[model samples]
Target: MATTLDAPGRGTRRARAPHPAPAVQAPTKKYRLAAAGFLSPALVLIAAFVVLPMVLTLWISLHRWSMFTPITDMEFVGLDNYRAVVASSTHMAAVRNTVVYVGLSAAVTIPLALLLALLLYFPQLRGRGVVRVLLFATYVVPTVAIVIIWSNVYAPGYGPLDNLLALVGVDSPGWLSNPDAALYSLVIFNVWQMLGYYVVLLVAGLTQIPEEVYEAARIDGAGPVRQTVSITVPLLRGALVFVLLMAVINSIQVFDPVYLLTQGGPVDATNVLSFDIQRTAFQNGLAGEASAMAFSLLVLLAAVAGILGAVRRRA
Candidate 1:
């Protein structure tokens, strides 16, 4: 405390020092232990399912192991598995098809998702709830059911698609039979199956944008398109990035439809990486080569994720 002289007629006044701000306390040992205890299950599961498998795969990729034979009897063939994968014509075709699939899927899905989200969000339209539910239900339905439905839809003759096309004066080209149309037909199937899911994801993102932003834009005399370009799209970047990443991952990992419907058939027209890896390992019994392919896919995904993360950080 300190005293200062007031006016001669007034008594002296006392002043006190200000209090210091409190420091942030570190977590106590008990708190830390509790956190670790809560996290242990997830950590253990990841170790067992993901990390250990990746390590074992890399080790196996260095050996020429017939999957049926014991690991101990394997011969070392470092880098040969990778070389063989890189050199295989079918493998290369799968890679090319994957690139096209990912690109085409994202191109169609993103814009459509955004458009549907905007429509669903901005308007208080009737039956919106029912529509949303129906769309999303398609995504959650069993893959076997989806494949069966699509198979019937794509049936060459007496199929609704072909019959409908005939009415429009356009002959239905073979949906899954012609190699030229097979991959494309699969892309269309993919779009129909996943469109609802993407739309919901985008709608959730749309809800995060403040209504006040749109209101302000209107006050400033900005039109709908201007507001979307300036406010909606810019604010929705995080969600857009996630949707694109998911689309690419889903496209690349496509296997079920190929396996069930086409059997990677019509002359391997629908051959994708996942189905190819399955065929290489289980059918051909080249475990090491299959391991190499799987590991390479892992690396590709990591690289893509890294690139997207870097771009997000920069932006």
Candidate 2:
């Protein structure tokens, strides 16, 4: 009877009985906002400089843009520029030259670097520190300075190298002027410039091999050559692959030597992809064609990188 009185008020009291406060939710929105704030600057810069430029280059590659034309005047030629560049004999020759340069550089640089590294890192070698310093010093020298110095050395009429060759009853070929020798001269210059860095890199790799392993091999009557081929080379496979890939990529992009030294040649014999791209864009006033060439080069580089990555994974 007492409970039946004032039903609305009783029900209200029962409903208002204390329940647990809502569980404190993680402030996910605030955290997201904070992360966005932290990342904003880098994301903005990347988009503005890299992403936007790449997009613009792709767009321009589809048009007939040139130095002579206004933005509005650019004809929407769609892949015509790409076709022209790919079909051009000059461009094809440049591509061939680039491949040759990369192949030759890799052929020369890898073994030479490995040999230098072995000579420097061998415990039997004397004056290892001095040799290392001398070799690595070339890496720090300015590119322009190196070019000038090599230019003097390779000078046809009056250079010391040519003079020495003349005294030895050998007529020196025009190293920079002759089309056949010009590319070889660039290769020599590149090898000399890159030799020290590779030596240092390989030496670093060699140092990581444990002394106990070599000692064990020695105890098994393994001589120096056997130890190198079986132990050292196997251990150094990673470093060798890294060096080979870098050399290939760098050789493909060779421009400075060809530009400052040969200007792509006595007859376009040394014109590589990079120099050709520059010449097409600036000298020939073919921006669209240049962009197409650049994109094609990018694709080629990407494919090479992918192959190297896959090989590394398999290893």
Candidate 3:
């Protein structure tokens, strides 16, 4: 019924209009306000507890102040407090003791911890779980209580240690009273207290390693020694790095044992920076000098952490 002319436009398809892409909707004003509301508490707490204290310490360090005097009476002393600290033999002894304590603690703690972790990591090991709990309990116990227990164990005569040594006809050395032994006694206590923590950390790292890796090593004729040296230690590097840094930090900040056991006594042998800081602030009433010492220790820790970070990155 239609000629080609009559069937108008039937053979030609019309081009459809292109649809536009959807617009990206920006967040509403209420969303940002709600986010701010959620973050405000944490922000305020950090400012009040962390940032404000740091700022106050820095401000105080620049002045000659005393706890006995009004804050308004603080005199601007610039770097004199720092200079005095540098020149003082007491501070120098503190620094030396801190270095030795940190060094020895890290040296003994890490390997001992690794060994303990390896001992407990086996599936067939009986009572491993109980042992882990007991060890960690010792760590979580109050530091003061730990010092008290160790003091009894190290008492000059008829102490548990002395009694044991007496069986072998050996005279007990003064653990806390002797200048040479006080710091080392504290070190031993630190190592014992910290060992379980590092073991836990290493155990966590050990779990991350796939069993397939060990199986492959076994297939390649690897003995337990080879497996540990080649496989376990290499893979546990990350955990070890963290443990080392933390151990050093803890060692440097040691005050509890020194305070409770030795009180930096026997010619100031057990004196470390933290105890010195307390002595300066409370005993000497040198608030400004204490602030300076605290800030200096902060700087040293920052530098040490930075160096460790760089080493970790390189490794």
lDDT of 2: 0.89
- What residue runs in model 2 are displaced by over 4 Å at the alpha carbon? 1-40, 124-126
Query: Model 2 over residues 118-235: C-alpha lDDT tens digits?
Result: 9888868778999999988887898889999999999997999899999989988899898888888888999999889889989999999999999999999999999999999999
Please, what is the TM-score per model?
0.93, 0.86, 0.89
Q: Model 1, residue 116: displacement in angstroms?
A: 0.8
Per residue, candidate 1 scores C-alpha lDDT tens digits across 59-105 of 98998999788878899999999999999999998888888878998
Model 3, 165-210: lDDT tens digits are 9999998878888887888988999999999888898899999888
Q: Which predicted model would earn the best TM-score?
A: 1
Q: With candidate 2 superimposed using the best TM-score fit, by how many Å does residue 269's alpha carbon deviate from the native?
A: 1.3
Alpha-carbon local distance difference test for all models: 0.90, 0.89, 0.90
lDDT of 1: 0.90
The per-candidate count of clashes, in order, stands at 0, 0, 0
Q: Which residue pairs in candidate 2 collide?
A: none
